[model samples]
Target chain A: MKQSLTQIHEMWERFPSVQKELQDVLFIIQDSLKANDKEVEKALLDMFRAGGKMLRPAFVIIIGQFYPGNASKLKHIAASIEMLHTATLVHDDIIDDSPERRHAPSIQSKFGKDIAAYAGDYLFAATFKTLAFHTDDMTVVRQSTKLLENILTGELTQRTNHYDRHMTLADYKEQIAGKTAALFVLSAQLGATNGDAPEEFVNLVTDFAYNVGMAFQILDDILDYQSTTKDLGKPTLQDVREGVYSAPLIIAMQNKPEIQKLLAKKESITNEEAIQLRDMVIASGAVDEATDLASEYTEKALDYLSQLPEGESKDTLVAISEALLERAN
Target chain B: MKQSLTQIHEMWERFPSVQKELQDVLFIIQDSLKANDKEVEKALLDMFRAGGKMLRPAFVIIIGQFYPGNASKLKHIAASIEMLHTATLVHDDIIDDSPERRHAPSIQSKFGKDIAAYAGDYLFAATFKTLAFHTDDMTVVRQSTKLLENILTGELTQRTNHYDRHMTLADYKEQIAGKTAALFVLSAQLGATNGDAPEEFVNLVTDFAYNVGMAFQILDDILDYQSTTKDLGKPTLQDVREGVYSAPLIIAMQNKPEIQKLLAKKESITNEEAIQLRDMVIASGAVDEATDLASEYTEKALDYLSQLPEGESKDTLVAISEALLERAN
Candidate 1:
């Protein structure tokens, strides 16, 4: 987390254009919100103020420079990516059935499910609206829209397979690809699409983004078991509580006979039982194995970055990749 | 309901272009559904075949003619409107918790809530994808996208105001604008845009479509209370069961103290209570009042049609307007 934060800070410090674009994107969304009724406006302001890490937007901006580095368009692209991430988080709060997020009452908890849903819808619509202003190229719109399609497909897969205990590691990977990595790829792809980068550079940067996304998500999964309730901001053990089986738990369940037995019982895995399973996951070397797998993805990301045309943006992207892999530790 | 069906049939019969576009739209949606997973494909097929009257597309075709319809562009416009309508229905099923629709298991019930949600998201994405292919005009896309924004806003408004006994007529109108009339208005506006109709013409046609939509929806509300279970292909008084108080109920609750008491009681309103309230609504002259309002809107639609350059399409549009008002009876 520390390394990831440092890398993000460096990227933010170096990219003045990224800062301006982000500001412009916020302006676009805020302008749209001004049309809402007073109550709706109040609710939207709360959502706006409950700021996130904006890591996804940062990734999008850094990668964007590899393609179209015009400071003007980068903000639109960056803001759009951030909006997508925010939309997912808003929806996730509902699906998780949690009452709070980011030290504030979750949108669903504060405004009710319907308002939260609309707020997400609003942001999603607003993101595209911003993009429409920035470019007339149908190709970009088509690709970005496809990215959203994949994300929803991933969400559906998660919902249908919840708590089944029969979900495979392959299926889990597919879900992550759809939900997490797809956006990263698109962010990188969009970056290149907007600029003079070669087609191969676009693909290479996309690979880097995808690998970093996978590593980031796997680390998130690891933290669900590894971190305490206070350290994570939200509740710990949320995935197990909500019936989501992330990579670490999925791997542990697959390899450990006792873990499989406990999962099959279908009773609430007590805190102690969850702790025992967590220990087994750690002891069986699956966490280490997962961490190693993440490192492989990180190295692949670095490999892609190494081949790209040399620039400060490229270096920042490589640093971001390193930060993601180190977060797993 | 019977009258609405007749109107739908009549509209299709009168317009060959509408027939062609309907076929093309259905085919396009079908082509979008070829998943590698057989089960998903089967579910999507079931959803597609769950026959609708295709009223939204019909509205598009009728309005397009007023603006000098191009048979080629009409296909894309009609298909996009229908796709948007279908997506809304899918999302509405999730919101309403409905188990059945149009005499078949609702999409959410059949595919589970998650898949249904994704299917809606997919359909929505496909709509933009299809639209993006046809044109890069920000005007058309902006109008269509704003339609979705309004629809979501209406859904949120309804959810927050649910079971509120004192909701104003303005509130009810706004909700209907978002929930029901938005797509109809979009259909007309998009048709005009595609047809290259003058801006004034677009305004008139969209206003006509909107009024017709309001009247149509009010009639739908009346049927929920007045129609029998078998006639509706649904259980009687189901709207009341779902806590969706409509205009008829609102009028009755205000005028008849006994009806108000029955609805306000802590217990669930019995079928008997629903019947009594329904009868009181009719007796209070509210049903007739709403019917007259529908007629006024119908006249306004006809007035717009009369001012248009006369053609067979104009006559059909007039017939459609008459049919819409006739539906309230």
Candidate 2:
């Protein structure tokens, strides 16, 4: 968490307004999580304190600046965007049966799924409340809620594809397109449109954001195979055991016979087998292949960023995109 | 489902406008569940068609009639209220590990908790989307969202008390106050105040709604002990097994050593012991004691109702309250 936090601080060191907006975003998030119930409050605050990169909220702030927008309004929206992301992560942990998040016990595992479920549900209430309270624009509210639907739909689709060793790279792309890219595209779109940015600018930034999100997710999938549990802030290769075929695994199994046979057994794949499968995939050089795919998208994102009128906002977008690519976890 | 529908249709037969709003409420709910993803939409729609009493939405429509509220806007708010209730029920089933709802497989049971969790999350999006779309009043949006927080807090509190054999009747009341009555009060308050109803009427109706909700919950608890699975539309006395002490169980255990001893084992209580506990609670006069307590709330609700100016709206609320009291399931 501090790794990306330091990166973000240095990257935004020159932009005082963006920093202020981020502070306000944090304030709004903290305020929203406060509850009349003590356990509810603590459960939610613990998750908040778990120290995510706050990357999505920062993306919202940075993108909002591409065109003129109200800082106060932007901060509240940014907070809502981040809260929605956090809420989804909480539920995702439960679905994946993940015991850890951000290097600590996950809400589901620590608090049990009962409190954790309520925590996620409560954050959702806070998410929309902040969004609706900040903006009078019904379009923004409507589209924001739809973004949530899109994300959950992506997750459900991913769930439906579990345990299929033959799951294609094409299917993986489609899943992340919904789960990851849609939010990024919207964060950028909302920021640009709220400022009344010209149509061309809005379209370009949204596309840029989309490509960036795709690349970000691919790099993340690679980290699962490459990074340690400490670095990743959670167990690695959990997705593989849970039958979620990430890009590297999907590509690796295409030519590897033993890998396919082990995964074919699904959950019956022993822990030792899972470790061997991970090693085999890494040895098969699918990690490098996945990195290449991520680079392609990063290049595409930069291409879109290049077409934008040169300014501080464009410069900041380029910096953030580069940093995401360089992330080890 | 048909039982309450027949009663509502007959009760509102004299007031066509109220019936029209209720019809529009259904339309809005149906529209909100329509999703871009087929699986998400199907899961949500199946839950919708599973047939709840539509009691909460009806409360909104019925209470709105006390003051001349705009039917169009009122229908939208009513729909959102019911959708929120449905959304909570979806999560509740997951938390309780309940297999059935309304005599059919619950969303969580039929679809599994992953889809069920998303379905609940999706409905929340729909809930806020519907609310924000129809009203310009930010207060309404903020308060409606807070209602969600209150409900979740109640649920978390209940979770904290799980397996406590010595749980009190007062504790049960506090839990239900947040879990059940808060929503009821909000429904009535929104209905009254939205139409520019007099404060005196609004206060009376909200109090009336609160008392009515308390009674409604107590009656529900009593039914858990008294009703058959087929009649209750879910397993009877499942709460006892789950360590959720309802009114009859709480009161019965206060004096019955056997009831307390059986509950002390918590989850280790054998299935046969749970059956015996349920039988003992029923054979005890605690069911009648719980019924008398429900009667007290019913009387208090009527006292509040009597203070309201004589009108068709008042009449409808009275009928609904009476019908709720008389329900076996």
Candidate 3:
């Protein structure tokens, strides 16, 4: 566990200055989740402590460094983004019926779905409240809200498309754009705006973040197929079991037509069947194909980063994009 | 059906000028819900067509009349409040597992819980996006977000306290303050601010709206016990069936110890037992007690309106408060 922590820490070493600031943002999140109801406070505190990569906040901090703005205010925006991300995870856990997150019993698992639902909602409200109150700029609030709209829409599309074996690559890409890329864009753009960067710089970061977000989610889908429960902190092929076919599964079906028939079946797939499907997907070279796609996105993100003025922030951004391509869990 | 429509239409007659604007807001909402996915759009459209009294938006229009600012902007804010209310109902139906709403099958019932969850979340994102983009005032956005916090927290408290027969009247009040009163306060306060009303008037309308909201919820609870399913548009004794003891049930339990014992049973109440409990609640005169309490709130709301400057809006506010007390369903 300590080695894993060290690996995670190494990923953020390029932006080491934001480490203490990120801790401050987490404390702000904890304080903001405090409700008149003690149970709500406890639930939120537990979820926060379960821990995450805090990647979204780090992105915000790293991008903000490119320009001149109040680091404290940027921290608040970063906290809001993380809380919003946390809120989505709470709901996603309920929707997925997963019993664990961050290697601990999930909020819904421990508190019941009903409480977990409200906890997710409370976090969302907290996110907006923090954005509206803490940020001096209304543009930041407005832009963040638009990003939230995209994220929820992506979620809606994904839910509607569940069990749809006919879902195409374009459809999957659109879903991930909403579910994943929207927030990345918001983080980078809002950070740039916070730093009082030029519009050209803001747009460049937005493009970079979009590609990074795409790569990040593609890698996540890949990890779901290849990583262990101990490493990914959840069971592998869980998405497929739930009838959600991510990038690799989608690409694999094109090569292995038999895989599509198995997925189309309405009944639950047995453990042996799931393993069979996993082997077929691996054998189809879909893993390699998806990896190449992720790398392509990461390359594009780096290309955008290179267009920005030379600075430590640009270097950190480039490092983060490259590191995302090589991540295993 | 015509009578019910007439009752609803009459309620909106006082604000004839804003009728077109209200329709425009609905169109904006419809446009916002349009996505690449047709299923999501259709579900949202159906839910919107299930229809509501549009009371929150009406309150915003009425309150805005008291000041002089952009009517169009106030309309946008009003739409956002209604969308927020709609979003809560979508989630609440899922939490309660309600099959029907507004005399039609609920979003969850028709589209499944997963889709309904996203639909609710989509509406919420739409609400915030509307508020952030349409209005120029950060204060309005900030205050509205705070109200949303209160609303979701109230919902959390309610969910946590489900089936607890020991739930105090104060606890119930606090829950309603968050769930019901907070939105009303937001409607009035935002409307007043949009119209450029003085801070004094804004605060006055907030107090007025808060009292109106409390009364509104008390009456809603009372109707849940007294009205037929056909009239209420859903089942009655639902609270008791679900172990959610509302106003009359709480008031009756104080007078009859047997009611407490019956409620303490963890098993689901049979149809016969629900009818019997209804009889006991009526026999205990708890209905009258709850009614008197609701009336007291309405009176306070009217008193606040009387303190405001004499205008058409004040008269309309008083009429609405009085009408709310007299509402049978």
**TM-score, one value per model:** 0.89, 0.90, 0.93
Docking class of 2: medium
lDDT of 2: 0.80
What is the descending DockQ order? 3, 2, 1
A313: Cα error in model 1, Å: 2.3
Off by over 4 Å in 3: A1-15, A327-329, B1-10, B13-15, B327-329
TM-score of chain A as modeled in candidate 1: 0.88
lDDT of 1 by residue, A205-235 (tens): 7787888788778887887767776777777
Q: Tens digit of lDDT per residue, candidate 2, span B216-295?
A: 99898887776677898776567776778889888898868787876767777665676677789878888888888988
Better of 1 and 3 by TM-score: 3
Give stretches of model 2 more than 4 Å off. Answer: A1-21, A134-137, A193-196, A254-259, A309-311, A327-329, B1-23, B134-137, B255-258, B282-284, B309-311, B327-329
lDDT of 3 by residue, B29-59 (tens): 7766765257877767666655677789888
The residue-by-residue lDDT of candidate 1 on B174-209, one tens digit each, is 788788887888887877777778878878877878
Query: Which ten contiguous residues of candidate 1 chain A have the minimum total lDDT?
Result: A1-10
- What are the Cα lDDT values of the candidates? 0.70, 0.80, 0.80
Model 1: which residue pairs collide? Answer: A21-A75, A64-A191, A67-A192, A67-A195, A68-A194, A68-A195
Candidate 2, residues A45-142, lDDT tens digits: the string is 66666666677888888888877778778788888888899999999998888988888888899888888888899888888777767765667777
Q: Alpha carbon lDDT of residue B4, candidate 2?
A: 23
